[model samples]
Target: MSRRHLAMLTATVLAAASLTACGSGDEPGDGGKTLTYWASNQGASLEADKEILQPELDKFEQQTGIKVNVEVVPWSDLLNRLLAAATTGQGPDVVNIGNTWSASLQATGALVEFDDATLDKVGGKDRFVPAALAAAGAPDKPPAAVPLYSLAYALYYNKQSFADAGITAPPTTWEEMAEAGRKLTGDGKWGLAVEGANPSENAHHAFTFAQQYGGEWFDAAGKPTFDTPQNVAAVKRYVDLMAVDKIVNPSNAEYAQNQSVSDFANGKAAMLLWQAAGANLKSQNMAADAYGVAPVPFLANPPAGGKQVNSMVAGINIAVFKHTKNLDGALEFVKFMTSDTEQVTLNKTYGSLPAVGTVAADPAFAADEQKVLAQTLATTAAPLPQVPEESTFETLVGTAIKELFADAASGRPVTEDSVREKLTRAQQQMR
Candidate 1:
């Protein structure tokens, strides 16, 4: 998200577009030919994803008379691979991208911008959840992608642990969460698990916490506000779980989201803040009845300025490449992927929610965890900031939190002064 990284990405996309456009003789029409797709791995493995999605692609091909080639890309390599294709002008016709990267990727002009006419081809903006749609691209710009899948964070608590601790229900506010943590901490288990080592995970929780404290990461003009008093307080509250409250393990400074979630599933921790982790828990042999889901905690008594907004719309989007030789086929493929039947089948395999509002009416989504998260995405979630530098914001803020955790783990002093000092440095670096 650094300007340097942005510059590098732009250069890669532009250079690739130019070279491919000049080097290749194929015009911008598929003429009812084959289409290549780069799908993010949504199942246990690449082969597993193929097993789940190839049938759907086969359906699309049979119905549309277009042969489809899919390459399942892992999460770690998707962006870099896309960048390489962008730079070389050899990327797939369609791709899946993290929604947070939509605006950033759009700025490169290597993606097909979905105008009103094209949007109608995919059932229009009205078909999708407004929040998820908003995240497909910047507000002022035509979207380069459409919402394909959706997710939102919620508190996942161990039901048995809560009952043993004499807690009747999941905590609805920060005060109660802390109290619950205290009660749940005495049996060789911590009350909460945190992804202190994962920048993206930490940055997301920071966003929710900052909003609850009535703080904004950016001004209307998109200036960094990382050092605001409310933001400082929110961050201090997060670190205190380890430093002051002693409810989180001090060594959690090295724990990523997967590790934290694993701890929660294995009963090493009583609570976890996660998004749609039901499948992973099931994989770990945690029974469906062993856990309960609730809204992420917010301030019980939000100070005069605080608000109760709880989550950010978190998920992936479907995008088409502008340089594809088969533009029409690519468009058709996008439509097929977003269709009601495909949406349900695909999201079911991914353990995520459908991006389309009407596509979510199935009773399967009414189960406890899915229902709570779907409700949160509909009622309380906000999109991450749409500015071009949003990724930069994540890296800076997430790194600062990681540093704070390291201080706690090392038994160093963690005062407000230290928090302000680190945050101020991050703000200055953004300039």
Candidate 2:
């Protein structure tokens, strides 16, 4: 899922409460001809997503005589809304979910499990990408959802900024990236833009950094190991980008709503670490040729246990609520959405890679940006720990990072001790 739509901690807690209250309910009548869908906001704006999706819904309606009433839910309210629906059994028949929430939501037992027999209704298990499928739910359990759109993080750099800085190529190592950032940071322009205040964004970077630092957020039992030495070092390293390195603008410490993306689009920043940023850039009027894409940088010198991973498996998944009266219509809609034709069409418009394997060779996804993201997703990306507590982990740990960013932006020293303190508090809360 894009960082742009990650829900806040409070909303997640409320949703979690609602999920605990979920129970089997009597099915309501829908006449078996209509389905309600709650889609994530994937475009530049809510209206933009509706404009892009309504046509496809209409196409499905024409083909199957089943109408889809779609609502583009903002990330802030999506999880809460879904949880309420799960508790009351009165929500949309079909919904889009952040892939990381698969295990957490699946634990509610309110979703229809896509076992082999159930999957046969929608193309079959072989039709999807393996990595994407793996993220749909916990291992050894039938997935609660199927991959809809695929994404991975990449480094987006301003081509002109690099040329002006006399840089010949994009950085492949973190040290090189910092060096380049130094050169790019002058004359009112900053080296990079980061969404410092966004907990979801912070957690995503934290996960990647922890992997590169030979750390894990959870142990073998799925318990949080957040305040470990490796994790402390990882969190400190990220906040130091502003507090110590001085490469990022201090003002960015409060950027939770994609102001960093705006900065990159307007050339106020030279680089961005983001997932599938092309469509968003285009929406901001940044030309296709204005920037270049490359795999996210890794450590110049990794520790003993450090992995080569650079990104987390990130994307959206589609699921059917078990309480839906129109189960057949809902399954048909899932089939329609994940079909190869729709995969190419929708993924292309959203600047995401197709989740279905059959569309991997489609010419629409042959662009440079897509290639970089595809390579990362296939090679270096690892999914977040697929535990039932994954959503709470995101909230607690992500908010910890957010608070640390606040300290950095406010001119406070960001030491390993401070990082450890924040992480320790988060872990304590999880208990």
Candidate 3:
């Protein structure tokens, strides 16, 4: 996270528990127990989150006679604030966190233990995506946090580019994708926008390919396997897209997570892999009619044993602080946030899908594009490692991966040995 984000988060921790920020012995009806809330910016605009939530908080206040003070934090500031709050014991009453961060934050003992009671309040464990809840909640236990929504990935390619290239269909296999890429590469165009400098994207593509190649990042127990030959070969092919094949662009040296999306949107790239939000299809910015969705391209003749895995999963969960002075108030708010009606409303307005299957299955939410994202999540998503150490690489590893791919693309002589050495070193650092 950036220093500015960390600073803002630190301020939030102070505001949440500083007897002053909660409102000094004010003249409120109650003796002043302001349940401070800190949330992420996943809801598009911060104003939107308030417009949707203020009514709920107002309702909660009216019904239960409790006051809630809320502050919206951007994604970058979330971890910093959480870290500050956790270390100081003066944070928001409730926190909205990335599901993948459960292990890291849980380690700090900053959150309450999820239980049968909360499970029922949040529509039960069965209500959420199994993979999501697995990542959101504590392992070997019910989730400490309730599922909010999922951010899913898909292949978003340029229809015009595909047409101009005389390609009528998207590739279903890695081989076909490569062949199609070769067909599409010419002049100023390239087949794929592979950023070897982006470790995060590389990691994501690695996971996506490992499935298509029939391997995974970890066994059932959650261990590193990126160095394995399947993954190594998978990484090789991704590198080869730039190295040997030369179907990827050189701009990838500077590409980040969603950089390729811009390239595809602007027609500079024929294919771009990214997290897809169908709700944005009709927006003025997106080429909705010119694009379509598909499961990621797979391997043609898997080495006879690889599995076809889909995209990785990401989302936020609401967690109650373990040390909140007001448990009753916190639980009350939790119930309000996870209610069936609340789920529908939040998903519709936030572009986030309901955590529970029932909520998505509801006639009310059926119209929302977020529901489609949720369905894609249910059947195809792979859970990223819940370990916090992985979160540390959100940027660093991505930078490394992007550089590695870019270096190879420029014929600067990056080799598997060098990349693997770094990756292996990273895994060891986690330990």
Candidate 4:
């Protein structure tokens, strides 16, 4: 299937905590004649996605007279395929990847540097959210990948839970959120929601919370910064919500991408923290008019210099592999995919918050739900550190946080100092 389809299906089938990378080159393709490009499981399968995406591919063939040999690999297999290809130079000519992979993949020197002039031929940075583009960039270098689509974290709440808790509206601060959560708890329901198992989601959510608490994951040099005073303090405070506050779901110890969203959607929880509100709510077919989405709650006491950092910014990025024999043809395909025309088509076929600024303004993503998302991506965005060590750090931090939550769920006394000690252990591994 297509990448978008894979994204949705993977939500139900795969744990959000994953390590799927694309474009390995360890072994070669069947015959070296075709420009074999591999992509992720966007929908049902490669063949299924071809129904929507293959037409686009066909158009490219007609326009450029370049035949693309396409392979659809499951997200589960993407990392292995890319590793194989990277080792053997047998990766695809074009690939779509999670924004988080930019740092790790780039560090291996497996991809080529993105050129500004060339990117302009594709969709320019002006077309995408600054932070989304930034995620695909080097610390001080220009972006390496062209974002194909984007998402931003927002607060999705169950109206029933809010009403039951006597909450007129969603909480506006972490302290107030805790109070609301407690009120919503009991009666076989959870107040707050989480993706505890998946570091892909957890680390970002933690980072977003850290921003509100005035924390940074990496220092100026892009080294591990989880041990920073602010980060440590923020993490301890966050973990306490489940461990000490007792407002979160105990089962959250193993949540992933859409799990929390599912909780809120099904009315099992009061709130879900995530990006891609509309797509994730999975409420498209269901009549969830009772659902309400809003910006993340602000911190009660503002950090000295930190603004209210709400949600993590994320997106799908498009990159042209260096080894594609059809350089000019591949370039044309890239331009077509990112162009305003293609963006419009993509939004309809697979609904995502679009990456291009103009397309975001289009009527397709026009509902109040989508409007707020676009705004978040444009203004509230804070790019996660674009460094290779980031994913590794997330895995370490996530495990500790999960343990803390488990302790809290069992009514154990969890302390900031204890979390700090855990951070120390994580720091050692990260380094």
Candidate with the greatest TM-score versus the true structure: 2
Query: Model 2: per-residue lDDT, tens digit, 302-365?
Result: 9999999999999999999998877888899999999988999999999999999999999999
Error of 3 at 130 (Å): 4.0
Candidate 3: regions farther than 4 A off: 1-33, 43-72, 129-131, 182-202, 218-223, 239-249, 256-259, 280-284, 349-352, 363-378, 386-399, 406-411
Which pairs in model 1 have colliding backbones? 16-87
TM-score of each prediction: 0.87, 0.93, 0.77, 0.81
Candidate 4 per-residue lDDT, tens place, 1-431, comes to: 12332232234324433333323232256233334566554443356556667777777768766556567665444543453444344457777767766775565555666777777667565766566677885677666577777767777788776887789988878888888889989989988888766655657767887888788877877677676777777777777678767788878876644567677767788887766555435433434477787877878887786666676667777776665555555667767777787888875455467667776668788776677677777778676777766555566777677776677666677777777787778887665
The models' CA-based lDDT, in order, is: 0.81, 0.87, 0.66, 0.67
Per-residue lDDT, model 2, residue 180, is: 95
Give lDDT for model 3.
Answer: 0.66
TM-score order of candidates, best first? 2, 1, 4, 3
Judging by lDDT, tell me the better candidate of 1 and 3: 1
Query: Positional deviation of 277 in candidate 3, in angstroms?
Result: 2.3
Off by over 4 Å in 2: 1-30
RMSD of 3: 5.4
